[model samples]
Target chain A: MPTMTDEQVRAHLTHEEDLSLLHEVSMKTAGVSRLEMCIQCGSCGGSCPSGMDMDHTPRMVFAMLRAGMRDEVLQSNTPWVCVSCYHCVVRCPQNVHITDVMYTLKAMAIREKKYRDVAAPEFAETFVEMVEKYGRSYEFGLATRHYLKHAPLRMVGMAAMGLGMLRKGRMSMKPRTIKGMDQLTAILNKAKEMELT
Target chain B: MSAYTFYPGCAMESNAKAYYTSLMAVAKPLGINLEEIEDWNCCGATEYVGMNLIPAYSLIARNLALAAKMGNKTVLSPCSACYLNLAKADHYMTERPALGEKVNEALAAGGLHYQPGSLDIRHLLDVLINDIGLDNLKAKVVRPLKGLRVAPYMGCMVPRPDYNNRWSDAEHPVELVEVLQAIGAEVVDFPGAATCCGGHMTQIGPETAFELIRRLISSAERSQADIMVTVCPMCQVNVDAYQGETNRHFGTNYQMPIVFFTQLVGLALGFPPDKLGFGTEITSTEKALARIGVDIPKPTEDTPHKQAGLPMPSCLRKNAKGKVQHAEKEAA
Candidate 1:
């Protein structure tokens, strides 16, 4: 894959629509009024655990939202770094829905296919694969796929560690399939439709 | 006279058979009827929703739909992953009508329709603590796990705030702690009770999962817990079955028996070793049970107290002073 340019990524305008939907949903679901409560305080950025990894801190994302800088915010790598630990939400003085906003932003970013690097996309891909396969998050499979996709060479080290687990019956080579897997596939399709729309 | 629709999920029948066996063994004595829902399926465990939220919730909702159809007010699940999936679906459906509609639409194909809030989704610990009542449990403890220190691990799914099913603070859940105390077990206040055990991550990426599992085990070890008690099979398997690998990966020596809450209940209920599936455990609970003076004899068909309606065991009778008085008030 070629290095995605700013203009190439900026052409995708659907993320703003996603943000709007997220805003609407967040308000209805969580009673979180993120759009109104943000005061440009920079508190969310200060408390972010992965702040250094982002080009724009969480607070900046909020600031950009206020400024209507849709393309810049959508194209940035900030949202993917958020681990969703809720630390920022707990520390926010204004009680902004920083984490929810981050999730929404990440979801939008994912939908737009504007991820700057492979990490977030790989993580999301592995997460979806686990759900599709097992109808639930298989943490072992998820971690393995994620590492294998993002950092291929890491597999050798992982294999060495897994060998010990394999011997002790901790790790199973075959994924356990749930009964009525077809019904589960139908559920995933419906969920995908809702998420896509 | 209390009965609940049971959703055993996949793990309870297979890898977590001990949890299922112990649960069945202990329930009848407490007069709690766990009627397995007919033609039940998996609850999508923890990963399904992460990958695709709609189907994951829908798959879980299918079980909830069956439970609702049976007209059982409370649907009890012993597995944490199943409990979380069911609870998350129920909560999300009630909270988000649009999402609920989408999920219901998916379920419509299967001829299943779930009306959110029609059924109460509860974890086994929730039933034991809320419905069964601690007073009754305290009265029935023939074996108080006194000398054995236990770390209560709730894992990630059961205590989260998502589906409004959480009974305690998500960060610091106390249902397990309260139950352990009722069984006369020493409950250790340990961190990571609500942390993820990396669930299915052990299969996908052993190194990452090991690191996460190591953190939880080490925290429990630091708190001086003799064993870890969990409500989820994934947690039990990851923590118990994977301890040796986790130890090898991290170069740490930690041998802690990970047991189901139901197994602990079985021990407290005076069930013998084989009945509670004690021998199946990787780390021996024999030493821990021995500390509590519960030297269960070898499995035998004609044990002295095999009959169902004998007066509570002598140890329990001694502790029953408080329980009988409480039961009398309720009866009145």
Candidate 2:
């Protein structure tokens, strides 16, 4: 992760590029405007289920945005903490588009190599890989791969659990792929082209 | 009669076979012809859009392109994730001209072009309530689910604030509840109906997934719902099959039967329990079915409903508050 002083963090946060992307995606998807509408009210912070676990509360993130602390905002562990529950969005008096902002910031953080933890992003990657390969999520494969990638030792315990499930017929060993793999491949490639540009 | 281009997604074929089976069984009685789009692909499920926006939307839009070409004005998706992706892509394309241009360019390579707003993408539940008309549905009841209490869980993807396709309030959507009641099932106004089931997260991070699932199931149990009815196969699998593991991980005991909306509809339509795919469920739907006096029979080849050619019952006619009027008014 990129390290920066308070002044540098503030400078990066205020930078035009950082703010522009955040503004763009929000307006494009949620029709939310004015990140400045946040009044630092505690409604969003209070309602967030994971608020206490967050280093920077949703309210604080908005405050930081107003202060133009782009680098600190991007590097902070705040964005990843949001569970996308829309609780903040529902309760926010300003309708400040908290979730969309978090999404954009996380994307920026990932692009800038400033993310704090790899858990959520890694999970997302595993999901994309499944779609790229099979055109669908292979549950058994995803479960095994997730453990193998994130917590290798957990596989031993999961294996025992898998055996138990197998005996009871709760789990299936065979992985199922979606029909029309070639068509799916073409779609994925098209998606990739858009991402590249 | 209603005709829709169908995007089954992947789960319908494998993990959620019961959902597909029940959907096919019940739809025929309602005169819903779900013509599958030819040469269709996955909607990238729940995760791809989060990882990469353009590719994810492109991936979803490819299916929409095919549905549009098949000359179907409406696309009905059984999976919540697929419904969300298709709706989101359609919303974004109409709202964002530049992105629409870029995606159209990509589709052009496949000899396809999607006109934004050319197709109305909807979930199966949306079609049932908005198109099939609950009043008409209420009249077709060969059997009514009078005593069974069900919590209608919409999961995450279907009703969020996206472009204008949001059919109900994002936090508390009761459209499914209204449909369940039309079928004579007691619908519970549960708290976690709109909660995420940790979806594909169950595979990538079981710990996080466990906590999320625990919260949802516990809430449903507390709400006193006997079984939870879902529109998404992914949600059904996560809540139905993984609840035991979630309980074990959290040291709590929950024996909730997670069922598809179609299965409950099938039961209410007087279809036998076996025909509704009740035997395949991890948690016994038998007791719930028994509550409504439905007996489980041996699995056999699904027989089509005898009452096939009847005109849609009067109650099913579009109401003034109906979705068709609402969309048409908006268009006018």
Tens-digit lDDT string for candidate 2 (A59-168): 88776665556677877776666666666776788867676567667666666777767866777677678777876666556666677778787665455334333322
lDDT (0 to 1) per candidate: 0.68, 0.71
Candidate 2 residue B136 C-alpha distance from true site, Å: 1.6
Worst 10 residues of 1 chain B by lDDT: B299-308
lDDT of 1 by residue, B191-295 (tens): 878776765546544565687788888899899888899888888888876777788788888888888888888887888767876755655566666777766
Relative to the true structure, candidate 1 reaches a TM of 0.70
Estimate, for each residue in B1-332, the C-alpha lDDT of model 2 and write its tens digit: 89999999877766677888899999999879989998577776655655666666677777888898888798899987777678867876776676677777767666667888788888898889888989878888888889899988887667765445456877788888898899888888798888778665566556666887888888888988888999888788788777777877988888888888898888778787667667666565767777877766532322111112213454553331153334334423
- All models, DockQ values? 0.11, 0.19
Cα deviation at A197, candidate 1, in Å, is 5.2
